[model samples]
Target: MPSHVWNGDDAPPNIHDVYDYIDRELKTLKTKLITKIEKQFFGGIEAIQFLIHIEEIFKSKHRIKRVKSLIPRISGWAELDLFTRTCYEVRRPGGGRDAGFTKDIQTFNAAFQRGIKSLTDLQDELKDLYCVVQTFCRNYQSLEGEFDLKWARETNLELKSAMRGIETLLEEAEEGVNIKLFSSDKFSLEVAETCDTKRYPVLRLFPDLFQKFHFSFHLIGKWRANDQIYLEDIQFKLIKTKRLQRLKHEEYNTLEIEHANLLSIIVEKRVRVKCREIRDRIKNLDQEITKLAGLKRSMMLEKSQTESDIQERKRHLFMNKNVTDIINSKDLDNILGVKKDIEILSKKLKSLNKSLKLNENDLVAKEKEKVALDTDYEDMRKSVSRSNQLAFERTELSKEISIINEKIQELEAIFYRKTDRNKLSQAFEDMKYPAGDDEE
Candidate 1:
């Protein structure tokens, strides 16, 4: 094999080339080792005794159980029996098994045959049984220490894993594993039948799961892409775009997530502003309504007092009519005195008529003013109602904004995981898998 040296600054060799070269080297080493052993042991020997000696040599190493067992199969009836049974099983799958299953079985059977042939081929290579045993013993002693260390280290990891599994089982026996059941309503009742009651910290449930936000503000804003959204004001003249798309392939998709979060914040800001404006307007309307009500009450009291004055004047006019009738019914001897009394009473009645007419005119004017105030008050109430509707629409926009934020977070989490996996894979691909030690 040609020696290859790796430079720190140079690019690593092709992975395929590395794999092919390793395969070639292993095959070459195995063939050369087998040839050397055969040449050193080329003589006559009984096959059964030869196989037994090889098995005995393999058995010396406790870790070599699999290879030791295979040695007997080189000349034993069990090997032929296994091959026959495998062939029979391969054909048996043809009756009702799937085509792919049958094909897989056949493939496995072929591999089994190849393995058997490879093992049995070593039988012919063992020419001089006594000489071959000595060579095997020597090779075994040379590699035994290294093999023991490698096997011990490999077994240690498996034993540790097993210990951990056993400890888990013990814990399960004492304190059972908790399995929670959840209802659609997000309400949970703990059922600790087998396990002891375990306290789990309370987690706030997602609002979207139970309550769907009204999307009445669909006209306000909407997501254009997974990471971006478009917003517009009531007049639709001011349009804003939020983007979170990645600039580079290596960059994280978190940019778009941040943009998604911004959408909610923006909506929240609008809601707060609109709410404040609505509140202020409502307060002004309430104050105006109160003033109108107070004015209407005062006007009503003034109207009642005017009506009472008119009644008093009418009563005096009636008293004067009775006095005038008495004067007319009196004798002609006191005509002059009666005339004077009549004149005074007539003047008083005339003054009362004029006052009554003035009061009636004032009442009519006040009634017209009161009607206008009532109309104004009703219009103000309608304006307040419309403002409330707008506030509700803004609230709906907020809920929808929350949902969009959650979706962005979910997408970010998924992308983050995939990005990590891709990074790890790229790192592995970039790694240099050395075939052997550096050559000078």
Candidate 2:
């Protein structure tokens, strides 16, 4: 009743069942033998051909026919049985010792065993080569991506830092000015005369004609705003005649003070303008220094990454070289003479690595030099700032001094003319008086 049972009994005992059972067994055995032959012999053949391909890659060919010839041809169960029986006979004691039994069976056994061993060894070698090739290809593929990512990240950080510096500089530039170099109402001017001779009362009343008086004045005030200048007041007043004896000292002093204050204001404004220019220049230099520092940092990071990449590549190349050398020594030793070629290739790779290292070193050195230049630029910028400030102060002081000197000269000239008129008036009065008395 079961699918496997042909009749009602648990086992089929008829002639037909017996023949069917034998046929099924033979078919199963044949399939097994065919599968074995395909897997072992055909697979071994493919492996040998792969080795031949590898040999061709090295540009050499060594004949490997012994292993190839040992593979048995088995198209059906009959040939498979024959091959098995032959193997059994070769292994049996004293079975193939007769003269009629040729040495082909022994040779087949030797070659078959050698082929199996060689196939296994070649498979391992190919596996190693495949692994090395895969690793090398993978590294090559990822190298550029890694470098680009690192560079982008580092560049971004540098850019951010630079942006922050710019923002700070901008904020500082926007702040108000604090320097005040000069101020009004801090100085006074006066005029006076120097006399070397005593004059008569008439000449005193008219000193201009009778007495030659040198007029001069000194500025005697100290600079208060920022301590940039100082002056001490001196007098250069002319002797008055009878007709002009009431000169208003208070009014004249007030006028001179007002003039001096105006001059002080002008000097202050000019100094402020020059100081603004200097501050602007300093701001520009600060921006430049910040930019250079950012650039230098970016270059340093890039150079470091470049060196790391070069070292990684060198290590990978060294590993590849070692693998190539090992494969040449172990697998391709007899097949192709690749040892010398591999050595030469390794040497070339080493030289290339060395060149890359040197290039990276040069770039690093250049970055260092640029950093030094950035420092120098910063120093120069500070010095320029100080120099500009000092120059502004000096220029303003000089202008103030010149203005004071001009005022003093004008006042002195005015005093000289007044003294001369007074002297002429006095002479006229004395002559008029004498003539009137003589006529009486």
Question: Per-model C-alpha lDDT, please?
Answer: 0.34, 0.35
In candidate 1, how many Å is residue 155 off? 30
Tell me each candidate's RMSD, in Å, in order. 25.5, 72.3
Lowest summed lDDT over 10 consecutive residues: which window, candidate 1? 201-210
Error of 2 at 68 (Å): 99
Best by TM-score: 1
- Give the residue spans of candidate 1 off by over 4 A: 1-78, 81-111, 115-330, 381-389, 392-396, 412-440
Q: Per-residue lDDT for 1-440 in model 2, tens only?
A: 33663321222333234234434433443343334432453344543342233223112111123322332232222332344344444342353333122343333334344433443343333233222212111111121121123433343344334333323322222121111111111110100012111211110111110010001000000101101110011121212121122223333444455555544544544555655665565566566556655665665566566556655555655555556545645454433334454455556556656655665665566566556656654545554555455556555655655554555455444333223445334433443354458654
Q: Could you give me the TM-score of model 2 versus the true structure?
A: 0.21
lDDT by residue (1-440, candidate 1, tens digit) is: 44764222233243223233333433443453344322222213332343233333222321234433433222122333343343334343234433343344334334333433432343222212212111111111111121223432333344334333323322332123222211122122211221112321111011110111111011111111101111112112111111321122112234344444545444544555655665565565556556655655665565565556556555655555566545553433345444555565556556555655655565455555546555654544554554455456555655555554554454444333223445323433343332474646
TM-score, prediction 1: 0.26
